[model samples]
Target: MLVLGIESSCDETGVAVVEATGPGVPVLRAHALHSQVDMHQAYGGVVPELASRDHIRRVLPLAQDVLARSGCALPDIDVVAYTRGPGLAGALLVGAGVACALGAALGKPVLGVHHLEGHLLSPFLSRDPPEFPFVALLVSGGHTQLMQVDGVGRYALLGETIDDAAGEAFDKSAKLLGLGYPGGPALSRLAEQGDPEAFKLPRPLLHSGDLDFSFAGLKTAVLTQAKKLGDGLEARKADLAAATEAAIVDVLVRKSLAALDASGLQRIVVAGGVGANRRLRAQLDAACGRRGVRVHYPELALCTDNGAMIAMAAAMRLQAGVQEAQPLYAFDVKPRWPLQELAAA
Candidate 1:
């Protein structure tokens, strides 16, 4: 089966094609992505309306590009998949609308996929794919969660963030440190030059005795520390960034280990944008290595929101017979759909 996937959940517009043969993992034939980071930089964050408009302009061209690169045409598409929700409503609508329109035009079935599920299942596209019954640490844009994934549709939510997620803490703390938009990467780059122990930052809910995470308090602590540094902030920016990254990585790494113990799973898959963090990866690698645990991650290029994950996820679902593509052209998007909801789908 050839699946065409579209992703316009936030500031990035992506499209891709995946081919699923027999019962093996799906392969990403081709993918295209256009980031709105430069466009949203001036505003310090994503403008939903602008994002929606850009998606309108980029989605089709990206789709065409993916098809051409994959040596396929419109008529060859078997399933049209799109990120259904848990994102900006306007952005989600763009992808959903386009996907449905295409499905309707081609008489092909369409599937609405959960954005987080795309992230959770993305690792299968990697060279060293993980097996079932593993833990997943998802630290996407505004979500941080831990889950026990038994299979394609079997997910047990172990814990999640109460307020600000790990990604939010990284971005917000970077903003507090005067880093521009797309702060997480910028902050992480600067952290390479400073001492992570230079500043004392709180590790919120680190001892909560549960898998749940809380990064809001850590952001608050960063703000307070920055305020105190007022005049000296510039000189200490890198140090502060490093400290903030350290604290966030600390919580994520520790909580992930706890989740592994609770689930009795020796393997863990880390996904989403924040999964690209160098500090987090290094820490998780070091920590998990100590316990003889296997850790998996999507290729760095796939760590961010992309169409490949969406297409791969949809292909997997279809292969597992867990979901069927719907012929209905009409659609609705969930800007706040919970990943756990798919457990019952």
Candidate 2:
């Protein structure tokens, strides 16, 4: 089966095609993505209305691009899938509207996928796909969660962030330091030049005896430190960035290991945008390695929001017989849908 997927849950617009043959990992035929980073840079963050408008302009063209690259015709599409929730409502509507429209035109069945599920299942598209029953650490834009994933549709929530997620901590801390838009990467880059121990930072809830994470306190600590260095903030920016990154990484690494121990799962899969951080990957790899645990991550290209993950996730759900593509074109999106909800789907 050939599945075409659309992702417009936020600032990026993505489209892709996947081919599923029999009961195995689906193959990514082709994918295209257009980031709205440049567009949203001036505003310091995503503008929902602007993002929705950009999706309107980019989705179809990206769809055409993916089809051409994959050498597939519109008539060959078997299923049309789209990220239906856990994102900006306007952005979700764009993808949902387009996907349903295409399904209606082609007489193909339509599937509305959970956005976080796309990120969670994305590792299946990697070169070394993980098997069932692994713990997943999702560090996406505003979400930080730990889940026990048994299979395509079997996910149990282990823990999640109560306030700001890890990604938010990075971005918020970066903004406080005068780093421009796309703060996570910017701060990380600056962190490479400074000593992580240069400034003391808090590791929130590091000893809470649970898997849940809290980065809001860390961001607060950063803000306080930044203010204390008001006169010489520019001179100490790199050191502060490094210290903040170290604090966040320390909590994550320790908590992940704790989760692994608690679940007794030897394998863990890291997904979502923050999973792309080199520091996080390095720390997790080293820590998990020492504990005789295996760590898996989506390819760098798939780290961010993308249609490939959505398509792969939809195909997997069908293969697992947990869900079905419906002929009904009417759809609604859940901007706050939880990943655990799919456990009952």
Candidate 3:
């Protein structure tokens, strides 16, 4: 079936068309995205109101682009899927409104997809994919979690950040180092020339023996280090970036392995924006390889928020018959929703 997916859970407005032929088998016909990163860059972070308004402006045009590119008209779209929650309230509503309206107009079914679920299933969109019963490490600006996946729509939260997410920590630390907004990528780029041993950063909750994570302490450690360096610290930026990256990667990798061991899941799937981190990928790849386990990652571009992942997830959910028939105006955005609460369709 052809599914139209809409995503506006964050700064990016995304739309895509996907087709599902069988269980765990989806084909992407076309996808289009509009990122408000530059708009939010001036504010150093996303402004919810601005984000919502932008989504309103872009979602329809993006949908049109997706349909034109895919050569599929409204009638060809069997279902409309949209992100329901765990994001900015206004942002979620934009996608929901458009999707619900489109579905109603087309006399088709609509499904509200969990954003993180889309991230977890993203690796399947790749040529080389991991099967069911795997561990998923979701690391993004707003969240960091480890989940056990037994099947489609079956997820068990194992561990998550108790404070700042790994990406947030990276961005915050980068700001302290004089880097501008969206610091995660900037910090990572600097780390390439950094000496990991130049500065020592704390690995918060590294040995907590639980799935929970804490990066607030690590951010403080970066602040303390910066203060100790005082002036003329520009030369040490790379070293600081490396240390921060290492510390964050260490905790994530260790906790991921622990989750794998606890769940006895040999395959690990990493998702979210931080999943694009070269160092994190390398570390997880090495750790999993050493343990004789397999690791999967979405294509680098797909690691960040995108419509393709949502489209693929929606197609799977539709194929599984996990959908609801609700009025177009009955939509609501969930700013905080747990992944474990979703039932397999």
Query: What 10-residue stretch in candidate 1 is worst by lDDT?
Result: 336-345
Q: What is the lDDT of candidate 1?
A: 0.95
Q: Order candidates by lDDT, high to low.
A: 1, 2, 3
Q: Tell me, what's the RMSD of every candidate?
A: 0.8, 0.8, 1.4
Angstrom error of the Cα, residue 120, model 2: value is 0.4
Tens digit per residue, CA lDDT, model 1, 1-345: 999999999998999999999989899999999999999999999999999999999999999999999999999999999999889999999999999999999999999999999999999999999999899999999999999999998998999999999888889988998899999999999999999999889999999999999999999999999899899999999999999999999999999999999999999999999999998999999999999999999999999999999999999999999999988999999999999988535
Indicate the TM-score of model 1.
Answer: 0.99
Which candidate wins on lDDT? Answer: 1
| List of clashing residue pairs for candidate 3 | none
Clashing pairs in 2: none
Task: Tell me the tens digit of each residue's lDDT in model 2 across 1-345.
Answer: 999999999999999999999998999999999999999999999999999999999999999999999999999999999999989999999999999999999999999998999999999999999998999999999999999998888898998999999999999999999999999999999999889999888899999999999999999999999999989999999999999999998998888888888888999999999899889999999998888888999999999999999999999998889898988999999999887776545
Per-residue lDDT of 202-320 in model 3, one digit per residue for the tens?
88888777999999999999999999888857878899889999999999999999999899878999999999999999998988899899999998878888888888887776666
